[model samples]
Target: MTEPSTKATPTTAERIRSAFARAGGAMLAVEGLEPAESPVHHLLDDGSFAITVPVDGAVAQLVVSAGQAGVQAVLEMTDYAPLPLREPVRSLVWVRGRLRDVPASEVSALLDLIAAEDPNPALLQVNSGNGDTDRDTRYALLRLEIDSVVVADSTGAESVGLSALLGARPDPFSAMESCWLQHMESAHREVVDRLASRLPVSLRRGRVRPLGLDRYGVQLRVEGDDGDHDVRLPFARPVDDISGLSQAIRVLMGCPFLNGLRARRL
Candidate 1:
């Protein structure tokens, strides 16, 4: 028997809904900046529906007016970034796989092996899709930025082009270990967890918390040796208004107390 007739191809909204369904994530189409207000339409499942189109504020309007200046992401050079690291707080998931005793502190080779395994167009897209000749150079630059970010994140800034490109100070905190932590939570998560477990101190979120400020510095409490001493990460307020974790790590590394802590941990 012949199959039943199907309707014409669904709308973009229908396709979007279907894609969300396959991914097991909810699809929320809000019209205004405030999700609750000015609801034009809502849909639980796939079908044609009207969407509220939020008016572009001055910022968005300016981006449209001037065009590409709004979107490109700079490398290690930029002072202000809307990148993931800019957030005041971040929940970092660093350990990817359950690491059985590797017998060495460095797993760089193993990570390289993983990288070698997945060398596909998807990987290229992950790195920097801007290599395509079809798109505008500006947009292409944006794609390269994203790709550069992922590579810098997966490998390391120095491993990618950022260290040379930006001549970035070895903020060590620049790695922040947060971006790589994403991989640790996925591909390297188990290994990271194993490493943490081996630490005399247990590692878990909220197990550590940033405490009160100390003399223009920030303090974090993690239960390890020294019985939860306030670990101060230094920060400097530059003439320019830029401040972040990089300052803290740079300060900690230079601290005599931290030098002792490093010696103890080693």
Candidate 2:
């Protein structure tokens, strides 16, 4: 079994990347244009993102025209757990960049590469004149060259640099976070209650819910009469795998001093 280590904290970029990848959809807004909500197709490692839009739609038209002038665009992605927590929104990532159409010749190769990393059936629909023109012409692919990133979550809001955003990797437990959080909420009420007991006396009066879990720590949402509070229960160390995560949880539960650390307003 691997042991947890308290060596490093997750950077803003890693957190943003994780949120971006997990988000099902995002609100894409261009300057001097209406915001359109679309499904996020893929997030490339180089900090570029691909989204699908109607070929003749307002967004597509704007992107094509603005690609020449270098128009500014923003992609807003929200991270929410599938579980029924009081406040399910875990984080928000705002990616600001210039939008442009990928070259026709490169679309297939790009989609193939994205599919190889995170396969989506929708990628198959973006054909380059090999099939029905009607079906293929209905949609277009747009790429955003990421310039700046801003993330808001329990910790707070801050602007992250492009290099940091490009270099960071998502959390090791990103894929399993939703499933584990849902399981804890559904089948482990008693465990949640026990964990809630570790909260401050003033916070104990309200309804406590498990908010999020990561390699670093567990977060709790306390719904008080005044308002809602998010508290992070830091682990003894950083976890990289399931066994290490389990040990961190045990250490958090057993040690009284290891209770919730920073309390941030959500």
Candidate 3:
């Protein structure tokens, strides 16, 4: 049987959703309001998200006033490698949309739905009868109807439509990216060095380090006396499984064509 190709691009929505899901909290900004940090309480199916804020805060008041009319807002979230390294930020996802408040009666069901999928302790505190009696009145749950989504990383930034995002799945390696990158950084110096040999002569003089890894390829950060440069080494094909990933890495290490590509990019 022929192996299926794993080199599929993640939809803008999928990338945004993945980043949002991984982010502990997001920076939220309303068109006419100040930016605030809010924890993501839940992500709905329609590319929308639920976030909590103090009921008495300016954000709550603005959202309440907007009501069904919805207020224009933007949410920015980022993914970072857990390991301590220079430029650990892996990718950034930005979401722009209409924001509105969830009614008191609907909050319970919404919270329940989110809990069923991914239970968060924060969600419990605001659940109907769990924590403070005045929790309902003290906290506000706002939904963002995503209008557009964009994701940026070492590769580049691209905009994604809501429909494409909803249909695309995140790369299989998305969850494991940090762990593998960390492992390579900590234990696989030789491998990284060998890969660096494939870079153009101009970049070889710099100190090369593994920067990022995804299903599509591996990136390296070359630090030189002059400055730093990032170069991506694309695999012969994308790999979803560990074995395939290993094979792809071997191909990248052995391929001469990459030298030309790297030279062109420089």
Candidate 4:
């Protein structure tokens, strides 16, 4: 199951772990599965994916476990062993068995099937020491560490973790993306909370108003009778312009209750 992320959810160590996970996902997107760019990522094949440590010392591991559809595809690809997922929801799956038996030619259908099951799941191939240099190989997998995140809700439970792939290491952009998200999770909470506190009770939705990062600053979805309104907010002042939040930044600055609030640098 996936878990929710809170203003103060995981510890510092966890943030680093989260960063590693985010990095792996980013890398897989760039290297393994470069689908037409969308809001989400996807992996497109069945192959072995491994993790490696960079000069940064911090590292993590992931396996492309199979899914229900993947189990079937593997069987079709190579006539492999008995396939059974007693309960898919409770376990992780990958394409390892199919990887060993099936050649790249037959793996495409299975990869496409898994992609259909989760169109946006991250997938990628890497160029690490253990990686295969063959330019034509591919694989499909679900990332282990990041499949869960908590939603802002009373249930206080984790969300279902999506499948992701981990291929090679990261590039400059990938590393920066990882660092950016990590920094935001660690530092942006106080800014959003303190700013949110100033708005009228009407502004806050249910007990669970998710933390949204946007172009203005931090946009809030004001749920109401018809639908929801997106209110742009500004970063807490003496602001930290770590990321571009667009118009969301301006509205928060104008909130009457938050007039005196200044963005604090982390």
Best by lDDT: 2
Q: Residue by residue across 1-266, what tens digits does model 1's lDDT show? A: 11121323222222222221222111121123222111122121112121111223332233244443433222111121112332222111110111011111222342233346322222222112234422221111011112232111111222223233233222322222234333323453333333333223433432333322222333343444334433333345321112343333334335423211111111
Q: Compare candidates 3 and 4 on TM-score and give the better one.
A: 3
Overall local distance difference test of candidate 2: 0.74
State each model's CA lDDT, in order.
0.25, 0.74, 0.71, 0.30
Q: How are the candidates ranked when ordered by TM-score, highest leading?
A: 2, 3, 4, 1
| lDDT at 19, model 3 | 72
Error of 3 at 55 (Å): 4.0
Q: What is the lDDT of candidate 3?
A: 0.71
* Regions of model 2 farther than 4 Å from truth: 1-9, 132-138, 255-266
Single out the weakest 10-residue window by summed lDDT for candidate 1. 91-100
Point out the worst 10-residue segment of candidate 3 by lDDT: 257-266
Report the Cα lDDT for residue 205, model 4: 59
Which lDDT tens digits does candidate 3 get at residues 1-266? Answer: 11123455445566666676567767788776778766654667877888776666788789888769988888888787556646678788878888898888888989878888767666654534345646544556788888887889765788987777767666776666767766767776667887888788888897887766767777788778776677777777667887777777767778533322110111
What C-alpha lDDT, on a 0 to 100 scale, does residue 137 get in candidate 1? Answer: 19
Candidate 2: tens digits of C-alpha lDDT, residues 1-266: 11233555567888887886688878888767778766645677666888776666788887777666656788898999666767789888888888888878888788778778877666665644466546633567888888888999867798988777778778888877777766767776766787787787888898888877888888788888887888777776788988777667766677544433221222
Highest TM-score, which number?
2
